[model samples]
Target: MVEVRMRVNGAVRSLEVEPRVSLLDALRDHLGLTGTKKGCNQGACGACTVLVDGERINSCLALAVQYAGREVVTIEGVAADGQAHPLQEAFIRNDGFQCGYCTSGQICSAIGMLAEHRAGVPSAVTEHLAADVELSAAEIRERMSGNLCRCGAYNGIVESIQDVAS
Candidate 1:
């Protein structure tokens, strides 16, 4: 087993894992951060989404060793001072979740999507190539396409993101 150290949430955490151990396993199994769920165990589902250096990625597809010394943020880290992050609040306020299985990934992906929008990253529906990217409903939908909600709470999910984006 190789030793990997990563800044999870806010503190540095060290654990031993095989080179092939997924970041999802390392977080949920090794570190006890179960908020990052394991769904599909493949890249197809965004249920294991998390942030690496402030960018969202599918944790199930990322090896733990590759993230050594990097900053990894899970759903547990999204809030500050024990208060729910604005997105989390918005999620509750907007009924963005159901079944609660995909909520964490949805929230994390939404946060990353917001960051991308603020940086003027364009999505598939973004029409104006030379202009500032607007966070239209279509753009939000396109950008968050990776995360699938089995409960079909997509309308609320989109609304939650829109609430925060605006």
Candidate 2:
């Protein structure tokens, strides 16, 4: 077992985890933060998405020990004082999910996506590398391709992201 310390949802957490333990298991099993779901248990699915130091990553692909001393944010951290984050509220208002299994990951990924856009990070669809990328529906869709909703809620998901981005 290896000791790892990380800031999760604004709280510092320390745990003894096996070297092979993924961050998803560490959060769910060790820290008891089930908000980050486990979908494919591989990098292909975004259901285990979480933010590490403000960047979105698949918790299933990242080992807990690799995240030591990093700042991690799960869906639970997105809200404040029981009030939903704007994206969360937008997801609800726009019906961005169904079955709810992928909602948390979707929201978390969206948060990072927006932050990336805000920082002027360009996507594959981005035109004119020197110019600010437009937050068009296409851009949003391209940037969010990693997170898939099996319920076919892409329309609502795109709408929710557009609502938050606008």
Whole-model lDDT, candidate 1? 0.90
By summed lDDT, the worst window of 10 consecutive residues in model 1 runs over 127-136
| Residue-wise C-alpha lDDT for candidate 1, range 93-153, written one tens digit per residue | 9999899899999999999988877776777887754334447788888999999999999
In candidate 2 the C-alpha lDDT for residue 81 amounts to 88
Per-residue accuracy of model 2 over 135-158 as CA lDDT, tens digit each: 888888899998989999999999
- Give the Cα error of residue 41 in candidate 1, in Å: 0.8
Model 1, C-alpha of 153: deviation from truth (Å): 0.2
Model 1 TM-score on a 0 to 1 scale: 0.96
